[model samples]
Each structure stands twice: as C-alpha cells, then as structure tokens.
Target: MRADRLVSLVLLLRQRGRLSAATLARELEVSTRTVLRDIEALSAAGVPVYAERGRHGGFALLPGFQTELTGLNHDEALALLVAGSRRGAQVFGLGSALASAMLKVVDALPESYRNTAAGAAQRLLIDPETDLLARRSVAEEVPDTIVAEVRRAVFAGHKLRIRYAAADQAPKWRTVDPIGLVTARDQGYLLATRSGADRTYRLSRISAAQELAEPAQRPERVDLDRAWQERSARFRTGGDQVTVSVRVDPARRAHLVDTALTIGAEEPEVDGWLRLEAVFQDPRHAEWAVWQLATHAEVLAPQWLRASLRERATTLATRYDVPPGESRPSRASAAATSAATRTPDSTAPSK
Candidate 1:
C-alpha cells in the first residue's frame, strides 16, 4: 500500500506540476506528515522532487522528469484518459483510486503524446450530471462502508449477509453466495445466489452488509457477463407486460418508441402518420408513454387505456377551460367550488 501511495505521490506531482503537502494529504486521504514522508521516500529513491518554501510554494518534480512506463500510442492514451473522465469509478467506490491511476497514465505517457492527449480529453465530455433538457441524473446512494463490504465479498468469493430493502417491503437480512457486481447507467447491483437460487440486489438497497469468513458455495469459475445478460433477458420478459396498438405522428415516432419495450407491426398511414403496435411494462406504463406525446400520438386499441387517457384529458380540459375574456378561477374560488360540490353526507363522520 505504501509503495502504491509512493507511486501515486510521484504521479500527482508529475501530472499537476506542483501540489502543496496539505493538498497531497487531502488527495491521498492521509495526514500532511504522511505526505512529507512519501516525498522523502520518493526523493531518496532518486526522484528529482523539490519543495519551495514561500506561501505560494509546493513540491514539484524537475522539468522533463517522467516515468518510463509509456507503451500506449497517442490514440490509446487519449481513449483511456477520456474513459477515466467518466463517472463509472464512483459507482464502485474507486473514485479516488481511479484518479490516482489516471494520474499515473498521464505521467507515464510519452512527452510528445501526453500534452495533446490530455488536452483532447478535456475537450470531450461524458455523462454530465445534467443533460440538455436540464434534467439531473440521480445516482443511487450506497454507503461507502456497505459497498466496500459487498465488493470484498464478491471479489473474495465469500458468502455475504445483507440487510436488503426490496421494493415496498421492510428490510430483511439474507445470506447469499456472491457472483459479481454489475453497474448499469450509474446504478449498482450485486448478482448472487441465495440457497442455490439466483438473486440480484441493488447496492443502494443494501442497508448493511457483512462478508462471511466461510467460502462461497458455487462454481469455481463463471462467465459474469453471460450471467448478467441471461438475468436481464429474464427480467425484461417476465414482467406484467402489456401490448398496445397506437398511431403516432412521424415527428413524434421516436418519442413513442423510446418508452416502449418493443415495437411490432408498423406501417405508414395514408395521412403520413405511422401506426404501430408497441409493448410496455403495463397499462400504466403505456398510458404514460402515450400521454407524454399529447395529440401527436393516439392509442388505437386497449379500450380501457383510451378511456383512462380520455378521462385525464377531460379533467385537464375542465381545469383549464374558461370563457372568452374571462380569467380562470383563483385557488380560493376553486376551493369554494369544491366545497360547494360536496354533499352533506360526504363530510359526515363515518359510522
């Protein structure tokens, strides 16, 4: 660990040019004293590390000093630097380690490629916290300690005990043989087996975790990617799914397709509108997807969904409708209208 820290210390100075002991301590998650010691160790090992004394001073490597670890060409190094900028490392509780490793990658690059690659990486952006629509992407929050415990068990091939909170149910403790951890779109899940049955638990829902000392009961080796794919296929197909036929405007077809799980039997109408049968998770899901497109899309079949949408549209129309040159009712007036609509028995105490 100290050797790794010592290498990280050198890489930090090499990448950032100059960094104060305090800054290094914070980055390394150690005390300033430890940073100072690491600096001494690096210098004693023939690294040309020097410190400046004034208030605006920090440790820096001599100019043109870099590690001889370069093998990647310019494009390969750029690809790595760009991938490193992504938020995947944070999903697995290795954000700081990723930073350190990225620093090493930069510091180890050939001087001819380093500056250009690093600058090019800065030009590209990946998965910003918010998108063009100004909608923020919310990542599931998993406690560091809990994730650490779960991660250890997965890698060490040990049974893991977790206080898991499944949807709409109280948290329950269960022991499972670990398979692997998978991250998709910033959400983390543990693929494991409980009592020889396949189980996948969201890392965020793990309120507590403990790695058992006993070895896991499972195959000696497995293909995690294939396993995850199989599980995903089952999940997508096994739900209470509903299929709906719909006609959508050409401009809004993509919008409709995005929310539906599958599309079948598509044909263009004479009026230039497109008709298609789409499958969604359920009726509610279908309603929501079609509703978002408003008049641009219309549900053709599933009479109940059409009625539900009609009722919702009617309610919205009633709420927004007003006579010409007349303003809509205020909150107080609306409240009075609601009160007036109630029968005497409506508010009467229950028997």
Candidate 2:
C-alpha cells in the first residue's frame, strides 16, 4: 500500500504540476501529516520537491524533473505501446494529449524496446482491403465535446446538466447523475439517474451537456452495464406479443421462411398455397413482418390486424400514386423503397 501510494502521489504531481497538502492527502488516502512527511522524504533525497503557502498556496516541483523507468521485457513494452497508441488519439478529450505523452514514454524507453515497438507499428497495416464499410446511419451525431463532458462527470461521480430532446417534447434541461456512457450498434446511450429513476438518453438527442458543481455520491450497488443490457433486451423483446397466421404459396413461403425476398402478400397466395405463423411485439411491426411474407403468406388471425394491413396497403398505394385495383410494386421495386427509408451514413458521429 505504501508503494502504491507513493507511485500514485508521484504520478499525480506529474499530472497536476502542483497540489495542496489537503488535496494530496484526500487523493492519496492519507493524512495531511503523512503527505508532509512524504514530501520531506522526497526533498531530502534531492527530488526537487518544493512547497509554498499563503494565498498562492500548495506544493510544486521545479521543472525538468526526470523519473527513471526500468525492467520491462520486449513483449511487455510492445503491449504497452499498442495500448497507449489505441488510447492516445483514438478517443476524445484526453486522447490526443495522452498520445503525445506516450511518445515521450517511447522515447524514454531503452533502444531495444523502442526499435521493437517502432518496427511493429510500421509492419502492421490496419487499412481495409475493400470499401465495404457503409457510412454511419445514426439519426443524429453526438458531439465529441458533449461526450467528453459526460465522461468527465461520470468518472468523477458528479452530476451533469443536459439539454435532452424527447420524442414528444421540446429540448429541456435536466440534472442527471451520470453512471456511464454506452455505444450500441448504431447509437450512443448515456445511463444516468434523475428523480430517483434510472434513465437512458440517446447521446445524439443530448444537444448540450455541462458539469454541475454539486457532487452527488453514486450508489455502490448499481452496475450500469448490467442494468442497461437488461433494459435494452426488454425493449427488443417485450412489445405486444402476438401470433399471426397467414396462408401463401408454398414455394414463396419456403423462400420467405428461408431466403430474403420481398413480395406482395397476395402474390404468393396466388402462386402456391403455404400456411405459417409467427410472433410479434406490435401489430404494425408484426404486420411489416407479414408484409415481407407477402405473395407467400396471408394474415389468418386477429381480424383487426388484417384490416390494418389493408389500410396500410391503401396508404402505400396513395403515396406511390397508384390507382385502386392496381397491383403494388414487385420485390425489386420494394427493395428500392426500403433503401429510401434508410437513414444516411453522413448523419452519424465522427470517430
């Protein structure tokens, strides 16, 4: 514990350049008396530690103090370099600064390890062979500055004031005690607590964020990742569960149940008869599922769903300027329609 404290204290001094005795004591989990004693030990050893009092307060070290680092193997050095590179310029806030710090670390390393790391960095190529990466399709981009602020508050166990936009209302400012930030497949989510309820806000919907001066203690019992995972799973599977029955062409039904094909619900029914059933959370989401089965599958149950499907069909016809009694688009035409509804990649946030 003494060694750990000493290491942390030295690193903290390096990071802050100066710190008050009270601040150092609190950060190092030691008494102010112990911090003063440690400072004495460092100074007695010619470590260049200095102290100042009164209005201009705290302790500082003279510039150009160099600490020695030793005893790391080639593999360990390579791993450290790789980790440093990934964390350096790859993320927001402290990333670029951290990366610059890593260059100093590499420069300080022994020649053998430095050459090994530099060689690895040069030999390794991370570029993609094909341009298969589709552009990001997030609804709105979350700004890096807001993300940095949220991260700071979350890590510091502080509350944050955020301007958040909800689906049914204008953007409103709220104070949230941030627990963590999460990035899902196509979105970023912030898990926080407000008014005694755990909530998740889409990062893109957060127009602005600022740290609150009030520091609220976080609950030690809360596991943010576990809580968010459970919440997200429920959202995916907990919608109104329904089983819809449909009859369609057996050939088309096989394809619907197997390959991906988009055809009219009636077309498959007209071609070859096939019967099927599936579950859904919402009637609309389920209807869309059945609509995908179109030409191959027909809605057999819950007359309301059947009626709703007809209304949807009518609406589609109107939108496309198709006359009544005219057949809807084929699978190829529908593919283009689906593509049109997709959000553009340009809307996503930058790396």
RMSD of each: 6.9, 16.9
**Local distance difference test, per candidate?**
0.83, 0.67
Q: In terms of TM-score, which candidate is strongest?
A: 1
CA lDDT of 184 in candidate 1?
Answer: 86
lDDT of 2 by residue, 150-206 (tens): 877886788999999986689999999887766554456788878877788987788
Regions of candidate 1 where Cα sits further than 4 Å from its true position: 1-6, 20-26, 29-55, 61-85, 110-113, 123-135, 267-270, 310-351
lDDT of 1 by residue, 1-351 (tens): 687678778778777888999999998989999999888988888999999989989999999786864344432343354355356556666665666667767776777998999899899887799998999877887877898898789878999999999977999999999998887888988999999999999999999999999999988889989999999888767778888989999999998888888898999999999999999987778889999999998888989999999989977886768766777787678779989997778768988
Model 2 error, position 24 (Å):
39
Candidate 1: C-alpha lDDT: 0.83
Which window of 10 residues has the lowest lDDT sum in candidate 2? 259-268
